[model samples]
Target: MGLTQFSFGALVRTRWAYALRGSQHESLLNTAYALEAAIDEIVFIFGPILAAFLATSVHPVSQLFVPTLACGIGGAVFFSLKNTVPPVLEPIDVVAAEIPDAQSNAVTGQPAPALQTAGDHAAPTPSPEDNGFRLRRLHRPYSAKPRNVLTYRGILPLLVVFVVFNMSFTAFDVSMTATMKAAGAERFLGLQLAMFAVGSCIGAVIFGSREMKGSHWRHMVMFLTLLTVGYVVFRMVMGNFLILGVMEILTGLCVSPLFATGNLIVKDIVPARSLTEGLSWVTTAGSVGTSFGSTIAGAVLDASSPHMSMMIPWIVTLCAVPLALLGWFLARKRPGRGTGRATNTAA
Candidate 1:
């Protein structure tokens, strides 16, 4: 249940997610978010630790195989666990389910029935044609119908921002290695990464252990701003390995917390009907970001001096800063952001 709660609750309604009789999607999403944060903290540590143990007997290529094997084994266990899988719906049942809304539904486009009142009229069922019901196969993509994915509600912008932020990170990483090589200390890469991962773990622990009470929007803004600062400092400290290691650690403190904040934001704003897809989009955004970052960083490295290549990350980080601010602004405007009291903020 703990592991598969997310995938298992696909058919769950937002109301049912909170109800006693059904699964609690909110709590499930919360726990999943925590697990994701923990993964970020551990991945960097895992690489070095795994490599150290494998170095004695196995070849270098075998070192790469270890993590891949771990992932496959872990995924098999997750899939085998009856609690993690979502309840499957029949094809007919899937098509029959309407996209629920506060007032009107998407597929049916009819107002939801309110509570019974003394003067309420007797309800009438619509014919199949009237309800837009059609016989169709399961081959169609789910998005062929209108979904409650909030494109205008800052979700797209946040994804864009996430891309740019990770772009900066990848660029910084490429240049960091190049700078270390240029300085004749190429062996320090693992140490720098380890320090950064340690800082991230500490940050995740601090955020996870504390009661999450503030607006996720505000936290996203603050954490991202701090992360931007870290990238800038990464550029400045390239000449000194000691300062570079410390700066990497300091910068890493924002990574897991920023990721957690983004998850919270998605949960708050993305409609329950499209939450799973929306979460997948976020993952896709990171992949796109990584592609943009690594490719551009390579070009920059080829064209400029090692120190000059840092500008790539610096510029991208600035771009992400504005997006983070805009995301925070839009999130503040969303209906429910967890903060009960309203105060003066920017438009």
Candidate 2:
């Protein structure tokens, strides 16, 4: 649900940009954003809503498949639309009938301009310079050059920080849902998640504004430290759903800048061709870490009390304080590295 809300809101802005810009690249990107937003919205809203309604009016487990089927249909519709549309407009060449070459001047060794037809009257062909067409030449977009691109070497460490941070948080998230349900507070869990998404959006906007002004890796570290404090507050509030929701929302607002900063970092460091692949690998690493966290958290639930589940996320999040410090240290060192000098104290 949290992911869906963020995705949908971004898509709204993206689609408008594409429509106004009328650029084929933007259009294709916007279409993808729209389809992804649709699928995520359906998946996030349908299953939980169905579970809620069925728990009250129908057999919960028996009707679960209805929502599952809805998700499948929604996904299929999105996929079909995606396939129906080409990714973007392809550059095409329009050809005209070739005119036979005329004899060259013997002394100057230059061919005479050919004749042309205009309104049934013959006209001398214009020179290449006057005609604005080269007989044989190569052309490419200004955006194509290697130096105009960024690469993974500059961005890999930033991605590493992102994956580590998200891995720790995702672990907390998996445990959070289970913990809330165990505490008999499942009714408000969806709403809490939605609020978290809202906060994240707000945070992203704020971070974007600041990034436009200048970079702030030290500030990010401070923010993460503060977010860790919020987690501590969250852990202390055991049975209160309202408090849990509020704290989680605050946590989202605090940490989302860090999430968004990763993208900015990628944009700075990665080349256009490899950006998607680099981001995918970063996400994959985070997923693997989340899986580990989930397994550890879930295992605690099976063998210990529900309250004990908070330990995993808390431990993992705390691990990030040192990691954040390291990130800040590296960021400071980055500028100095270009000049081959050490400026700041080491982490």
Candidate 3:
């Protein structure tokens, strides 16, 4: 199941990147992410209801058939759109061959004569090496040797933020379940969770529809701060069922935008060649955080109380704020670091 999820997530993100390769506009990327997130939230909102019905009406195993069929059909449809698929980039050597002879001399470690003009004062042409350097700088952002995604400035901090942010967010799930159980209203747990997804879907639509300005890192920090505040409110209203439901909806508002912005940051920072891998890492980090948060929240609920479990989200989010800030600082320190837009590259 983990492998299947990882594969699905990686492929989906890669496909999105490919589909959006032509348009590097921030608003377009945000809208695409928002739409995808909203769809996911809709699935989350209704998937369980359908599963429950199937399990109750038929065999429990029957619920799995729906998703299996959906995956097969979705994959077929997605792959059928050949025009949307990005072409595999040509090799560096092939690209280099396209350069003019004067520029290519630099690449081949050969010297070329300076430009001569009709007048006595000849034009002072740049050296072959200088021309080559300039050509490479113009063509691609990264070095000939591809570096690991984590090696990029600000990436490590951003990934750390991803892990912690997801951990805190997911802890709410376990805490909410515990809270409902403690209140002897376990049946309402699904409704409570669905409200959260509903709010996230609404938030994604609103966020994606607008054009946002400012650095993505700063945007992430702002959203993280809002999420932290929401979690704090969640902690305060744990006991009241109706109030808790409302808080869940309010808090969930930040979830999709937060993730969508994170993806934007990854796109900005990672090179074209490594974009898919970088996205997969983000997905992996979230998965790891989810597993860790669930385990920790469950243990806390078992050992202590539901209230204590609720505390985990805000606490971790509080910790994540500094990491987000660190990412912002690092990004600022390195000018032109993530400013280079990624192009389609071969695997």
Q: How close is candidate 1 to the true structure, as a TM-score?
A: 0.69
lDDT of 1 by residue, 1-347 (tens): 22433432222222222232234333444444554676666876777767966875787577878766766787567557665334432223345634345555545676654555667677455555544555652344543564556563778788988798878767777887788787777776767667778778777776766645566767777787787787778777778778878887788878887776676566567644455666656766876898898888889889887777787776876787778778777766767533212322223
Model 2: CA > 4 A from native: 1-49, 52-111, 114-151, 173-198, 201-212, 216-223, 239-242, 302-308, 321-347
Residues 1-347 of candidate 3: C-alpha lDDT, one tens digit per residue? 65655355555666677776656463376788777778878998999989998988999799999998998898888778887665656334324423347666788777765567688475776565543444453454344667789987788898888888788856898999888887899998889878889888988998889867777777788888988998898899888879977877887888888888887788777766677788888888887888888888989998999889999998888889999988878766754544345321101
Each candidate structure's TM-score, on Cα atoms with residue i matched to residue i, is 0.69, 0.56, 0.80
After superposition of all CA atoms, the RMSD between model 3 and the true structure is: 8.9
TM-score-based ranking: 3, 1, 2
Instruction: Give the lDDT of residue 275 in candidate 3.
Output: 77
lDDT of 2: 0.53
lDDT of 2 by residue, 1-347 (tens): 42432222332332333343434443233233333333433444455656777777887575767755755785566446542332333233434434334443445566655556567475655656644455454334433443422232434455555555655565566667877787787776677556555555555555544323344455556666777777677678846767877777677666555544443344334433334444455455555677677677778878886577776655666676676566555554543323111212133
Evaluate residue 243 in candidate 1 and report its C-alpha lDDT on the 0 to 100 scale: 88
Q: Which of the predicted structures, 2 or 3, would earn the higher lDDT when compared with the native?
A: 3
Model 1 regions more than 4 Å off? 1-32, 48-57, 86-152, 332-347
Cα displacement (angstroms), candidate 2, residue 289, comes to 3.6
| All candidates: CA RMSD (Å) | 11.1, 8.8, 8.9
Identify the leading candidate in terms of lDDT.
3
- Candidate 2 vs. truth: CA RMSD? 8.8
